[model samples]
Target: MIDKRCSDTELVSLYQTGNEAAFEMLLHRHKSRVYTAIYLIVKDRYEAEDLLQDTFIKAINTIKAGRYNEEGKFLPWVCRIAHNLAIDHFRKRKRYPEVTLEDGSQLFDSMRFAEESYEDKQMFRDTRSRMRDLIKELPDEQKQVLIMRHYLQMTFQEIAERTEVSINTALGRMRYALINLRKKMIKNNIAYDENFYPKRFDQVSIPRGQQGPDERD
Candidate 1:
């Protein structure tokens, strides 16, 4: 029997030596963390599951092709791939709903139980619902940019290429989207913890030679 507690480094080394069971063990250990991360960004349980499978398939191909270099943190590398895959998926689809529990009882339980306080759990649910409503109110362009940047974890440059906009344009749109969302939340009397929704939105900067958030200016 494979030791479930084998470190990522050990599993990766074994995989490089052609031990398929090591790869399986590695996948089992990080599957939930990876899937949850993707689901958080994509906000769709079914779509997240699909993307998770697709990510592992790609990883397998990369490994077979000798393209996977284990620099030690295997799970992080896998997660980066999964994150990019989720972003690509969203770019092709062009829209995403806000994160939700929906029929994903396992995911909900994982997130809720992970929270240390019952109040925190309730706040998470409420915040998710409010975010869903806010997303619907955004202009099409703003909404698309926000989804790609936040949910899909795509960098501004990646978003620019996918959306056919300049990097700067992508950044500006994200900034404006946050501003609009903040305004909407205030206007609608929605309460949330800023720590949970910090200015992480503003860190998205687009490249130059592109329009800013006011492109619709």
Candidate 2:
């Protein structure tokens, strides 16, 4: 019973005009990408689905309250809402499970061995598997920061605010994490290039004009 002719933005505008079916159309258009982003972070299909529903509900309320602003793309705005909601869910739970790529099908497999031959594929798989295991060996704080920075594409300042640490502290934890991961790779005789990871944490100089850590509080 959905109108296939209308675009997402048009559907959103209709919803704002009190057309209920238009909201359903918008939800149908964006649900997959929003769910995928949440699943990538939460790593649970059921949880991702639940979060996706909740996200849409929240978005509806936001629009109803006249708080929705048409920004970049409608999908990315939905994605940001889902991302923040997932983060809040984890914070409230106080313990989050490690995200696995096992459920991600061929898409996950392709990322690790996209450029290699059959022979190299198996080798890359083995190496990447071992590296993931070693990454798990890092301390929780370090692991969270690294995952947020690399996997979630969060900046150092974002990680600091999320983890309730100073930017310098977040940078320091990332530095130590890299050193530990590198040491593990070396010990296992793995030939990972240092450039593949965040290695310039030491070279990051805080700007002088920025407020000091003490001043912000």
Which TM-score value belongs to model 1? Answer: 0.49
TM-scores, all candidates, are: 0.49, 0.45
lDDT of 2 by residue, 188-208 (tens): 888866576543211223566
lDDT of 1: 0.66
Q: Worst lDDT window (10 residues) for model 1?
A: 104-113
Off by over 4 Å in 1: 1-44, 69-125, 194-217
**Cα distance off (Å), candidate 2, residue 112:** 14
Candidate 1 residue-wise lDDT at 191: 77
State the C-alpha lDDT per candidate.
0.66, 0.65
